[model samples]
Target chain A: MTKVKVAINGYGTIGKRVADAVALQDDMEIIGIAKTRPNFETVMAKDKGFNVYTLADRVGAMEKEGIEVSGTVEEMIKAADVVVDCTPGKVGATNKDLYEKAGIKAIWQGGEAHTLTGCSFNAETNYDEALGKDFVRVVSCNTTGLCRVLSPLDKEFGVKKARVTLLRRAADPGDIKTGPINAIVPNPIKLPSHHGPDVKTVIPNIDIATTAVKLPTTLMHLHTINLELEKECTAEDVESVLAEQSRVRFVGQGITSTAEIMELAKDLGRSRGDMWENCIWNESITMYEGELYFFQAIHQESDVIPENIDAIRAMMELESDASRSIEITNKTMGI
Target chain B: MTKVKVAINGYGTIGKRVADAVALQDDMEIIGIAKTRPNFETVMAKDKGFNVYTLADRVGAMEKEGIEVSGTVEEMIKAADVVVDCTPGKVGATNKDLYEKAGIKAIWQGGEAHTLTGCSFNAETNYDEALGKDFVRVVSCNTTGLCRVLSPLDKEFGVKKARVTLLRRAADPGDIKTGPINAIVPNPIKLPSHHGPDVKTVIPNIDIATTAVKLPTTLMHLHTINLELEKECTAEDVESVLAEQSRVRFVGQGITSTAEIMELAKDLGRSRGDMWENCIWNESITMYEGELYFFQAIHQESDVIPENIDAIRAMMELESDASRSIEITNKTMGI
Candidate 1:
């Protein structure tokens, strides 16, 4: 089978991780990476043997900075079968017309509004929805983390409602400028943060409400979740379902925090100490009076990497079975 | 006003903080602090002018270690108006018979089973239940934190049910031996971790379920709470209620994590950087579709201090009004 040509637009946090993951897949090829500047990331992308494409107007500036460029983003888009847009929030919406004009399918990040793609994708939740679709928006790190757990719970127990409080990292570790240096800030200062609504785009019927606060830590985002089930169940019953999921890892006894999990990932020789699986402390899974509660940590930089790869297979119709695609993506990326 | 003589048993963690808070109260006097051994904490207690007493059998050993003993635990109990039993876990149960034999009213920590005391105390929730009681158990740091928020929510909006996930601290900062060094561990490993039932001890009528996971930090415990209200309310409405309560401190923007909260406490010159208030990030308080949600940090080491003081006031019948007692405790302890 011929490899599906893939172009990653926006070479930053999500984009870089997704590019590495896409390169690892046997069924996918990295046609190029698009960047707006000739920064260190562009040089690193070039060093990784990925062709670096700049914006059509920025190519000259990139070349002036002594960084070699393969072509413009337009050229890369035209050459690739599908493009994954990992640009900063809202930028993807602007790039939609360009991808549509090129007649190439595209994948957008969670930062992009869901309306930009009309369909939000999560491999575990709504993989089939992306099949044969022209564009798909992979939900944010927090939303993807939620779907990984909620999808299975909804399927097995039937969710009545879900309330999630997201303890978000202030900024990506690599980004030095973003705050909150000394305070926890609520992103929206409103009820039902955009995350729950984002999830609805993928699973329309589930009732979820989310409130988010940004913490000063950059290691990972912690989610405290409570799901009201359709019927009564034991903590063990809920654990059994979460334990069986491929993307969900039950962190038992010894592993305590996201810091320890990250250390374990490094010790396991994972690239950049990235843990692609949602680390849900097994002991934390509790069921009481018809509700399921648990605490899970998400590696913001890498948890969505596998989802992006799954989305690629989804958009191109390269794999009809989500499980099969997820399995392949997980195995290839060492998730 | 004649000051109530208070004996603090167990001179570590909660015991130490309770002793300090009790000392701050104009109506209470720390008669002595009980310690099994002459450790550094015992020395520190003595340096603070607290009368340090050792177990009868360890009195000689304590004296030999250059620690001056004011009296034996038995003598301290017999002389005090009320003995606060801060002994570790099940040990409190063993000491209960001693307190009863001495005819001294006693207060126990949350670690002790609620059955041991017959009355569990959260000043805001059950100050009246504790009034004139021979024995009272102050709920755990986590439960104390929950009650501070839930008591108000239940009173104003009428809570139908509450689900809380406690992100607990692995150990108190001063303790070197306690974990979890590298992982998040769920204590009890069962549904409705003892916390929910513990809360029932304070507010018997409110429906609440709690699950707890100990993270790798000793700074503080974070609670993600969802309360299902009997009627609809807005986030601002819920914030207004929490703000009116003295123990619930609304942490607005610019204060990001527990680490920062601790820093602010230090900047404010709090002893040991203790924050008695439940630091609820104001912006995090949100209500959606008749359900309320928010994130709050509990300074595990110090939050229960004020509750312990209030417990003493209630047990002695010195303060019949819960609000009045809470106000005095909070004002005196710099909560």
Candidate 2:
């Protein structure tokens, strides 16, 4: 079988992780990775043996750093079977023309709005919809994590309504700039923050309302979910159903905070201490008056990495089944 | 009539404004102000002709700064009939003993939990409840702003339920350390953030839920409120009701953002550009499907200043009616 050639644009947090995960897949080969700057990330990418590509203006900077530049981003996209546009939030829209010119399938990350692709993809929920599609978007990290649990829970217990409070990390750990170092801030200050609507793009029928706040920590995004189940169920029933889902972990062994969860990820020898699963606190699971309550920590940096891999497979028609795609991606990445 | 001797403990943001507001009131006398540091704020306090007091340990810092130190916080509290503990959060809980021992009534700011005083205050709703009370806690800035509008709306239209989304400032403008300089963060990541319960402390029967997120701005907190009214009302009726409120202003005439509201406050030549009113966007007021919707900006620094003044009057029994105290406080501060 011919390997699916994947070109990753933007070699920062999500881009770097997705590149590594794609490299591990048996049916995929990374053509090149794009970087806007010749920072330490590019040095690390080169050390990892991934070809570094830059914009025409930034090529001088990359060569100045003694890093080999394969070609411009436009040239990189032209060579790949699929281009994963991980450029920052709205930059994906501007890059759409290049992908269309290349005439190859492209995948965009959650940063771009759903209208850019018209179809949002989550391996567990909407992989089939993305099969053989020319363009698809992997929903954001938070939305991806939400779908991992809510979709399965809805199918199993039938969700009447879902309310989520996201205690979001101020920034990724490596990020030194972004912060409200000693404050708790409400993000949108608008009811049903966009997360709920973003989730609907993937799980359209799921009724979920999300409220989020940014605190002083840069560890992981902790979600406090309260779901009103249509069918009566016990905590054990909910636990078993969630446990059966991939990329969802029941974490409880004196692991009380998001800090400890990150420590666990590092101790587990995971790459870059990346937690690719929804780390749900086992002790927090509760069944009260037909409503299920639980807390889950989503590593904002890497939770969506696997979804990006599966999205690539689905878009390339390399994998017909989502579960098979997820299985293959997980085994290859050691997730 | 004897003046109410008011001592402000913690001469920072709220404390300084409260001191100015108190000095304006005919029935109140500023005994002194407390400061933990000899910062520029304390310098301003001295320049404003207010006496400054520090802790016994912090006396040297004040002396070194060449600012006159009146006495210790303990000594300041003893001289006053009522003490407003404007110290940072949790610090007020410790200061409660100082007020109790000094045999003076104390008013704590919203930073302290409602349980700290058992009686939470919003002058518009709970002034009578605070009458002659030895210990009363004033709710936070956001809660005070909510009460200013919600209480009057509930009385006029009979609110069934209220939902609010808070777009909170990461920090006050003077704060240089706190930030998420380029990101929006969910402050608590929990449903029905504490603001809702804080509001209940004032309007105990009203059902309200709040979700908040913090952004990079430090201008003011903007709230999007949705209320389900028991009685049907049009946008015009809701507008008229809020328009008549003492500390709530209908902001229009091309005022589109919180920064603009702050600009308006500064242009009005208000002290410190502090807006003590709930600057509601008149254009945002909407009545749809038996619910009222609008956006209001809460000046986190000054919205609670007027409430602190009213709390002192209520606690001192200087004013018998809530409206009388609110009127006196508003007129004195030019709110």
Candidate 1 structure quality by residue, lDDT tens digits, A195-258: 8888888889999888776655678888878888986788889889988999888776566567
C-alpha lDDT values of all predictions: 0.84, 0.84
Position A269, candidate 1: lDDT = 98
For candidate 1, give the lDDT of residue B297: 89
Superposed Cα deviation of residue B138, candidate 2 (Å): 2.3
For residues A31-86, could you state the per-residue lDDT of candidate 2 as single tens digits? Answer: 99999898899999999999989999999888988988999999998899999888
DockQ of each model vs. true complex: 0.26, 0.08
Q: What CAPRI grade goes to candidate 1? A: acceptable
| Docking class for candidate 2 | incorrect
- Provide the lowest-lDDT 10-residue window in model 2 chain B: B182-191
Model 1 chain A, TM-score vs. native: 0.97
